[model samples]
Target: MESSSHQDSVDSTPVSYESSQHSQLSPSYPRAQTTSLSLSSTPVNDQAHNGYSSPATSVSPQPEEPFKAPSPAVTRKKLSGYVGFANLPNQVHRKSVRKGFQFTAMVVGESGLGKSTLINTLFSTTIKPQRLYSQPGSELPSTVSVESTSADIEENGVRLRLTVVDTPGFGDYVNNDESWKPIVDNIEARFDAYLEQENRVNRQKMVDNRVHACLYFLQPTGHSLKPIDIEFMRRLHQKVNLIPIIAKSDTMTDEEILVFKQRVLRDINYHQIQIFSAPIYDNEDEETLGENEAIASKIPFAVVGSTSLVQSAITGQEIRGRSYPWGVVEVDNEDHCDFVKLRQMLIRTHMEDLRERTNLVLYERYRTEKLLGMGVAQDPTVFKEINPAAKMAEERTLHEAKLSKMEAEMKMVFQQKVQEKEAKLKQSEEELYARHKEMKDALEKQRLELEEKKRRVESGRPLTPDRPSVGQQQSQKKRFGLGK
Candidate 1:
């Protein structure tokens, strides 16, 4: 019996193992399949085929259940390796360097204000040719002419495509009422061109011809801004970044330059004109912030531009400046003028910022207005992002609306049910009243008839006229069968 029991246990082990395996492999199969697998499978078939009998001591049932493979959709896989995307800034810098950059600056001033000399000296190269002093009796231009000059300049392997737009004879004419018209028109034309390019179906090659910065040269006179200068700045302040500079500052004394800068800034503020101020970023270090502040403090920069290299009498060193009867005025000298600060802000620091502002703020405002004027509307929700608080508020409003509607419907249904029940109750009450009245009338009639019969009997009157009297019973009996 012991051997038999052990043998039965060993034989059943493989059957149970196979059934469990099948169940784990296919958990979706019906229970009948599991029962059949356990009942039909036999380990004896394998033992007979191999001509081997199971050793009782070696046979044992599994102690653990079968493992089920998880569903593919819910299974999570761990990453085995790392991919590098931290070099994105390097990639963008490389791409920008390869593509090069373009910047267009507009210069507006009257003739003989050293606009050409300033441009040549600012770039440290001959961008504009040096002009000779106008000879007497020479004809002056009657109208302002828009002229552009471009140069590809490189420094330390970095290339810059600089374009300077010079407005000749801006304030030279006597009738300068509409002097700012051409400049405004040119700026608008550039904006229109950019807008047209954006609306095109294929924009593979986009040329940025828009003016990023406008350098307005104020004459170095000790007085305030002229009417033409005020009008020009007013017209173009919203359209471009305005940077005011006191041109030919060498002619003005130190005290005159200081007082002139104050008066110019005061007039600008009074007229509500916006000048380009260096933007301070939150992430900038203290040193950088200080540098930017120093640059901005020298607004309406007092600049003296000179392309000629002259020997300084004090240091005997050659510098780009002009010779005066008193002494040499070095162009790069901070004590002499603010040319270093101007160059630093215009080229070294804020070039890209100027471009960014022109494209994002100034151009965007113009584009929005233009599109609206053309009767094109934009959906306000297009620029909105999904915020959890706002979304929850909106969802709560909708849910409240739904709940209020449901409550109103329920109230209406309950009222209708109550009205119907009231009507039915009223009808049943009326029917019961009518039935009670009819029964009362019948009972009253029966009582009246009984009273009349009692009255007749008491008064000794016959109840019916055809019936015999009670005293004539003998005559009645003789006349009927009662006599027999």
Candidate 2:
């Protein structure tokens, strides 16, 4: 019976099932026949030669059809879910690329949102002790401004110099002040020089626009655009990429953050920036990035957040509380916070843009200064206060190093004066936009009233006056200008 069963298994396709002792025991045995028959159903064993031979003798009948694999369900899962692979094959070029894209930035934000704090922390040094202002009603200056400070720190074998610009809070002073202007004017002036490009840049880049980037800081308060912040941005919009940063994010709730983002999207016309909160570091981006991280990180976080390779330092296995205690705090609703997100965004997405911008700025500086040689054209003025040789080499562009410094000086001296002017200017603009809106609303209302009056008049009733138009006063003002 077994022999018959084996015969049935081999069928037209003969599968040879062998055992070392098969010839001794069972060449003729029924069990041997059964084994031969069932050979087709068994998995193929790897042969000594390791390759399979064609089943020309037809050892096994093919299953009714080849095994059909299960179909994968479509879902929203992103490739990022895969670790390591999510990043990319060994970032072999990345290490060198990271070396290539070290960036530096100096940006300012609305005061009190911890811009300065972030800068100091990133650098792991005290930039300038933030002057604690005696609460209002006290005699102390609302803020003792942190003297501008910058330094070079080595991290993970990379040397980066960071200059943190701790700008005093704008638009928040309680008293009537005119201090914002000259500083703004100076910034506008420096920016204007870059924009005007009468000089200071290559002809190719000298197109009407200016400045490689301008990162605007927005606090975690509400999304309502402050008149002053909007004013500042509008002035620089034509010149720089307006990056709006969200500071002190730890203070904001998730809902608030969403509302803020939506509000900014609706209110501000520029592209929604890499909006980030505190504790968020610039992360590395791959696809659109040109390898390295952004130069702006070398500059200041208040100015820009993540750049390509410039990862934020989270508390890692090697890091301890004394080193990065703050990393313990929650951010963006996650217990395990990753500041690197912000860093990666800036570094990867904007890295090339940053490097190109920096190099261009350097070249422009060199050409515009028109120095014949370090020996001949070197300005002694830059070196007087330091080791002359070192200072000379360090600050050949000393004049430009004072770019924001010059602006700040103007602020220090004329803060009150500028504040007064800004107020007037602000009032004028508000009056203008508001006046136009009012006129538009009034014109529509008046036309409707006129129709009503005409309807009543057509019916033979009396027409009443549509009241004084807003322009009645403006007409008076124009007459004043005419008198002038």
Candidate 3:
């Protein structure tokens, strides 16, 4: 039964079961018949002579296909529960409030411009140190002196570190040629301080002492910006945000102030002086934009600064203003003066903006110039993550421009060289022609002389007159030799 099963398995393909059984049972069998009768299902193995081959007759490996990345899904996910991340702004607000804020302002003007009083009224804090009034004959300060006052004011759980820098005796000297130097030096010193602190290895206790805004108090002369004012603004405009103010506005009449403001604005525009204008952002609402515009329109603010409160006769209420024989000039009243707008800009509206501009724009510009002057080089493409395509486009345009410039320069050089070579060749050709003409003239002269000589010889004519022979001369001279 086992042998029959084996025969059946062996002869599954070709040989019959009877032939397989006969071959297996026979002790001696013909090799050809046995080999021909045997049926195998396994593949045949062939031996190769020289090269590598598989044990099987016909086999080849198929190349594996490269792997491909799966495409990302472009579907929006729906939240199953509230993540509570909408409170990020509130979180930022709380953190900012807790950290508090610091702002430094600089007041630059002549003496008696009410700079200190304006500062006090703006922040509603006594940051300026009280100074005693000098007698009529007191000697004036020889030079401008810088004074600083600082205070910590808190209101509604918000703390503010306010600093006020005052410049006294500015424009007070008879010869104020370089009067703005001290102020400029002070501002630069503050910048240096901040830069030094930044360059330090440890910066935990870095203090920002740089000035943010400069309040330039112009004298209320009912005219235009004085030489000192113009020069000072020109020197310091790029350093700090300038806020020009018309001090002692009560002294000027309404029409006079209006004309003066126009004149001042014209002068500023003509000189290309930049003043601190309120920035209107894209996200601002109409009301805010309107307010900003209003504030901006009131530049060179004609202001009356008074830290005292007085009762208004018209309204019969307590207000911050100056009482005079004619009427009360309200400080906070927009109709009376622009103190309210100035205060609003200095403290209420754009205090943070002032600081931000000082730190970001002015300081960064100064830092860049300073670093470059110090032989420091920086790659301009370090922080270009925002709008990479636009940056690339800009760079490509610049590169093309550079390449075009180089090509133009090379073409010009090549043209110049060609022209020089042509000029040299022309000059050499003229020289060669002159030389050839000279040689030809010389050769013609020689040929003419030789031809004349040949003609003289061919004509059988003596080249010179015939002369007597020595023997004939002696024989002929024998007759005449007795005399000599």
Tens-digit per-residue lDDT, 1-484, candidate 1: 0111211011211111011101111000010000000111122111211232222122223335433434448677767777567688779877877777778888899888888888777777766665555789998666776777667765544556667788877888778988888788888888888898888898877778788889999988766677777788989988888999999888989877776776666557656677888776668899988987787778888899888889999899887889989999998889999988888788777778788888877887788788889999954333333455666887899999999999999999999999999999999999999999999999999999999999999999989887668658877888786865
Candidate of highest TM-score: 3
What does candidate 2's lDDT look like per residue over 57-78, in tens digits? 2223233543344566988865
Write model 3 residue lDDT over 359-436, tens digit each, in one string. Answer: 776787788788889999854543223355666898999999999999999999999999999999999999999999
Overall local distance difference test of candidate 1: 0.72
Ranking by lDDT: 1, 3, 2
- Candidate 1 residue 134 Cα shift, in angstroms, is 7.2
Q: Estimate each model's TM-score.
A: 0.62, 0.37, 0.63
Q: What is candidate 2's CA lDDT for residue 443?
A: 97
lDDT of each: 0.72, 0.42, 0.72
lDDT of 1 at 366: 80
